[model samples]
Target: MDLCLKLGLLLVIYTAVNASDISVYIPQIAQKITTNVTDRSFVLVQPNCIFTQYPTTNVWVVVALNKSFSTISDSALSTPIPYSSYRNGLYNYYHTLLVSAGKYPCLPSDSTSNKVIQIGSETCKGNQFCNGVLSNNQTYRAKFILLNSSGIFDTTKWSNEIILQQGKSFQGNTGLPSGRSGGMIVLTSILSVLMAFLLLSVIAALIFGGRDLCWKRTMLNQKHSDRNMDFMPRSTYRSRYDNMYLVS
Candidate 1:
């Protein structure tokens, strides 16, 4: 009987330790990358998190612009209500809408889940629907709040400030420096012009050198022909007449 009791106690202790070991990790937001789709520019935002023991029921993510960390902390503390249940207040206080787990759909038992959110030039219309689009060459930050089905927020599990920026080329704003495509085009054009100029210079040099060599050869041939004419034999009659005069 005593052995049975000891074994049962050990089992309970092991279960408790295992359950405590399971913890939900804070979400990490990836750096924003700009991409062109159908002649339009867009920013891709991907945030990821992991669960060891517990299954994730819901996730609330938001992107705030031009706000400091202290301000975000204050707002987060002030609003104990989950974003799913309360949205109007969230829009008023925060910058953007909340993305829930239901919309994204991730397996709770999975070690990690990465969800993508796309921000386009038209996303921000300066209306109540969404916060205005992100500015070009401007820095922004994102926040992820995890919760359960009962709208209970895990204050301890939250993301740190994830910073990202948009390039000047985003959304047809060409005021900034050149992008990858533009820079390549400019460089290629310059190289092509230089190559053409070098080829022309080489061809001109060869043509002029050949002409100079031909002129020198023609002059040397003319001089040699004149010398041969001067050395030719005199008429035989003229030579005989001179010998007869000497004999007389």
Candidate 2:
């Protein structure tokens, strides 16, 4: 009779623990990079809540296939809360969101939340640990998963869907330049080539043109020497010889 009572109590305790599952909230806002969005990399604005609520904790920036999670209208995360936490450990380990904390934490009085982080493979650094590379022209949704000493504490809701488009170069976030800078690079190259061609033309003119100019100067000098010979002043001997020849 005592053994049966103990088993019943144990079952009740287990049920109570299991009943309290992880909680989910709407995904926080992710500021898409308006200026320099590229195929392999982008930017995201850190959520405002982390600075005060979970100062010691860090954040993880994650991207997955579009429509994989609940839409904005769903109110909560699309996947099972427990499963999402599980995937948090299993997926993208390299991308821990970066923020300043501790002695130099974000101030509540500050107007903005925090500095932004660039989400490219090359741009990702410090605590980020996921694969660090992103696909080009692939559509994906992004969110922030908060982490504490134990593990994942909570996750924000999914941000709006974004598409990373293809650009000129190899794949992944390996520093492929984009936006205004990309156009500037091409323009600069064209200008460099034209300048080189112009330089060569000037050099050729100097080499051949110098020789032609020298020849013209020499001809003029020769003409002047011939004219001087024809107008030579007559000597006394030459005048006598001329008169004798004329009388004969």
Candidate 3:
């Protein structure tokens, strides 16, 4: 009995310890890619983090066109010059405006014109402001950055660059998977305890009930044997007395 209690206590402690080890803040980002049929093209950015509610931060979507996969330097993006205007090689790097939290379909903002450009338009005429036309069959890579309200970047929290091809749609998750919240961990622990207790109760009842049934059956068999012995002796004594009376 004492051993059973010790094991149960150990199980509960093990569960609690394991649950505590789980990380509460696991960063993640979900990206969706789409294309426009017109002359201009850009990747729409959407950002999601496991700890989104805890911080009020701005998300920046950065794109490097036709560049080999390389670490995006802070200096390259943080400069006063807008990314669309800065030319590195054959293609230019572009970044979107500061996206508010929980916003979707973050369109790229043109740095030179200081306006959001239409997705598929060719020229900056009428309602359409041409940012840059993405050539079909070209490849573009993009990433996301999390920054504080004061424009300070969190070096630890950034997404892996995802490559998208022109006229093709891509979707995927970036970064570590999200961990369970405090409430969910607590709920899981409670359920485990309840199930363990229920299992123990069932095992104990089966053992005790089996013992009681065996004892009742043994007592019933003993009573039947005693009654048979008593009846046989009475019949033998009555037969002997009748024989002696007939001989006299």
Candidate 4:
């Protein structure tokens, strides 16, 4: 009887623990990018997003359209990105959505399931050209709104908004005082000129100062030779009596 009771208690405890595990689902929405000047449509690039729960952390996986959608046609239904996190491990999934030129309103087909929403869009009001019976040529702004199911958790919950704009361009070697490759060349040339000047200065100093040193040494050697010549006895001397004095 005691063993059965213990077994029953263990079963109850396991169920309680699993019930407290947190599950989060987020829905994605996006605004189609359009411009008045050109009929090109674009979308914002996916960026890292963060989700925080007390003592629990999560990362976002972005999803978007696989192909460009037109203004006249409806967006094709695509798959949603599936991402999940239990604790330290990251479960990220990539999916795509279809967006067109006009404003798109979306809601999940299943309302009973708990989920959150994230909308992606751009900021520039670029114009799109439409060759239709009636021209709808106007600059349209992109907007994204995030929504969550009601009564999911007790923590503070609200929709988050993000706007996209024209990304900064890569200004290649332009608008600089020196050109891209020219800067290095100029620096190298300056260094070479300075080195050449230093070498020339050293050579000039050596030419003037070394001449004096060389001349003094040569004159000293010549004087020593003359003294040696004077001390030597002459081979043409007739006899010792002929020369009265000894030369040292």
1-248, model 2: which lDDT tens digit per residue?
Answer: 99999999998876544322112333433344464456776666644534343456655555665745443322232221322332344532123344433322444645443445556545333433433545664566667665565665565566677677666443334454644466788899999999999999999999999999999999999999888767876685588689999999
lDDT of each: 0.48, 0.55, 0.48, 0.33
TM-score (C-alpha) between model 3 and the true structure: 0.34
lDDT (tens digit, per residue) of candidate 3 on 124-228 = 233221244444444555555555645535323233433334443211132322354557878889999999999999999999999999999999899997787
Question: lDDT winner among the candidates?
Answer: 2
My TM-score estimates for the predictions, one after another, are 0.35, 0.47, 0.34, 0.24
Off by over 4 Å in 4: 1-188, 204-212, 227-248
Candidate order by decreasing TM-score: 2, 1, 3, 4
Winner of 2 and 3 under lDDT: 2
The candidate maximizing TM-score is 2
Per-candidate alpha-carbon RMSD to the true structure: 14.0, 11.5, 28.5, 18.3
lDDT of candidate 3 vs native?
Answer: 0.48
Tens-digit lDDT track of model 1 for 97-129: 444534533434342333445543444434443
Two-way TM-score contest, 2 vs 3, winner = 2
Count of backbone clashes, every candidate in sequence: 0, 11, 0, 9
CA lDDT, candidate 2, residue 195: 100
Tell me the lDDT of model 3 at 107. 37
Cα-based RMSD of candidate 4? 18.3
| Residue-level error in angstroms, candidate 2, position 201 | 6.1
